[model samples]
Target: MTSLTLVVFSLLAGLLLWQFYRLTVACRRANRVDWGRGWMNLLDGLNRLFCYRYHRLNVLGMRLPKQGPAIVVANHVSGLDPMLLLASARRPLRFIIAREEYQRYGLNWLFRAIGCIPVDREKKPEQALREALRCLRNGEVVALFPHGKIHLDSDPPRRIKAGAIRLSQITGAPIVPHHISGVRGEGGVISGVLLRSHARIKSTSPIYPEEWGREQLQALVQAVLDNKSEDLESIAN
Candidate 1:
């Protein structure tokens, strides 16, 4: 099938899966279900079909905390990063998406099926942070893009927003640095010579308790971006 056909099929399949999850499978009834993990199994088939070839590197260190819950704070490189993580992470992950994106009827059900949490960028920031803490306290892994918005650059990433750091302090959940390396583009045709641009991702061996500070988060992300830049530069030369 053509790319358009594949995209249409994927959307239809996603919608049907979302409905199945809500009516017979979406997380519901506290203690009745793992709530955080209920929909993952249902989406396995769709993920295989739709998600492009993605490579995960250095995942050996990624792990579930033995005691409670934690946040997976990562750099945002592409729109497909969420699906890549969902297919790879053994634990169910809840994502923090903007409230406007969540309210749109077309996406709400599909996102809900995957257990994403919505934040109102225009409203109370503290309220969004609190909701994040609540999810962590309940033993759920939460994913947040610290960049807040996309920054296309070869330099170190833009300053990460404060919410991920503040939540680290509030919940004491270690901020595991998730780095998505090697994704880039703007005007190039989606097909063509971009073969090398396939997504390459890795989660740092979880940044430690004392290391969850904002400066620490910035340093870790910068280092990862630098390493990625060097690799690309070497390939060019």
Candidate 2:
């Protein structure tokens, strides 16, 4: 190549790199992500891009404490649900996921890095609970889907599990509920991530365990997840 051509090519590459760096910084700032790891921060940027740009995810009234122990509960719809939550959260969330999903081929390492606690439903599930308790004790955020599995909004009525309520009662961490909708690939994991969606995440105010009984709290969470609550207002940051 000629010297002038080489110089022009180098300048164009430099400009592209500079633009990419700016974009990454903007993404991290928008997502409130500072994972203390370059690779993780990069992954967070990619996640923001996928959720915000690719899926067109519209997050409404979702805000968590700047620094504290909290439990985030959402309806399990598609595999993309976690991504939506993570993108909306200001703090790092340690997810309580199913063991089988956590152990998925090629994704286990990523899951572990993100502090995912795996529970075997048929086996000793309390093991995961203990781990989550420990995280909350350390003032970390733990997120889980109370419905246990992917139960769509149109499916038959199913009761949510009591783990989130119990955790809130034990740790004094408020339970933040969110409802997800508009996922194109509603059931499959890979498909959920790959397909384009006009996703919407509706977040409600945190439910403090001191305000209600166990059964009542469970019912409230279910109502919020089912989008049946009348006073589901978004909490202000």
Give the TM-scores of the predictions, in the order they appear: 0.66, 0.85
Error of 2 at 13 (Å): 9.5
Q: Candidate 2, which ten residues in sequence have the lowest lDDT sum?
A: 228-237
Query: On residues 1-237, what C-alpha lDDT tens digit does candidate 1 reach at each position?
Result: 999999999999999998977644322321121334545444553453333432322234355565567777766655655655664565667889888877877879878786678887777766667778889889778888777765444545476676766776667777666566555432232321233345555655555546445665555545443345564344334
lDDT tens string, model 2, 90-136?
78889998899899999999999998999998999999999999999
Best by TM-score: 2
lDDT of 1 at 91: 68
Q: Which 10 successive residues of model 1 have the least lDDT summed? A: 26-35
